[model samples]
Target: DTAVSQTPKYLVTQMGNDKSIKCEQNLGHDTMYWYKQDSKKFLKIMFSYNNKELIINETVPNRFSPKSPDKAHLNLHINSLELGDSAVYFCASSQDGKDYNIQYFGAGTRLSVL
Candidate 1:
């Protein structure tokens, strides 16, 4: 079974349109996170939730939102998508408050805005 899976491994669309990416983990972890990796391969944390409660909301734009229905699922919704929003979105997870641990990542959903 897949540990983590995200829909539309690749997404292509135009600017100002709205889109969403869904993520799920089967590892039964208590925490999940969304991260964006730019073309330069720099990763930045966007949002994180532990046990369905929001714990971290980074400097991401208002156009982007994250929803966690449960401890195992976290979805990202983007509105008025912009060219800058075109990047690799990765869903990751780790044991809550366990720093020094590696976060399991999905293959990634690449969003391309034209």
Candidate 2:
């Protein structure tokens, strides 16, 4: 079984559309995160959830929202998607409040906006 999984491994949409990606993990982790990898291959954290409580990165725009229905799931929603939103999104899970915990990443969802 996959430790982390993301649905709709590919997403193609026009600007101003709304899209969502779902993720789930079975590793019994308490924290889950959403990361965006730009074309330049820079990966940055968009949002994080610990036990269903949200902790968003300040640099992330409000257009991105992360919802964690439970400790093992984290979903990302993008409203009014822009061309700049076209990137690979990754879902990850790790133990909560651990500085050295290793995060397991799911296969990324590639989003293309035109």
Candidate 3:
């Protein structure tokens, strides 16, 4: 079983289009998060949910939305995609630092705007 998984490892699409990335974790953690990594490899948290409730919403654009159907799954949807939005999106989960935990990351979804 995978600790965290994301589909469509690479995606190439035209600008102004919409796309979605799916993620799931099996670590039985209550907190899940989404992060964006730019070409510079700077990882920043976008959104975080704990126990199905949103606990953190970073300065992410409105076009980017995160949905968690359950504590084990968090999906990201981006509308009107722009070239600037093309980056590697990662899904992560942690134990909320309760046990000095570190965030576990997925393989990441690479979105490329054409």
Top candidate (TM-score): 3
Between prediction 1 and prediction 3, the one with superior TM-score is 3
| Model 3 ranges with Cα > 4 A deviation | none
Scored by Cα lDDT, where does model 3 land? 0.94
TM-score per candidate, chains pooled: 0.95, 0.94, 0.96
Sort by TM-score, best first: 3, 1, 2
> Per-residue lDDT of 1-114 in model 1, one digit per residue for the tens?
889899979999999999999999998889899999999999999999999999999988999989998999999999999999989999998886566557999999999999
Error of 1 at 4 (Å): 1.0
How would you encode candidate 3's per-residue C-alpha lDDT over 6-88 as one tens digit per residue?
98799999999999999999999999999999999999999999988999999989999899999999999999999999899
TM-score of model 3 vs. true structure? 0.96
| TM-score of candidate 2 on Cα atoms, chains taken together | 0.94
The C-alpha lDDT values of all candidates are 0.93, 0.91, 0.94
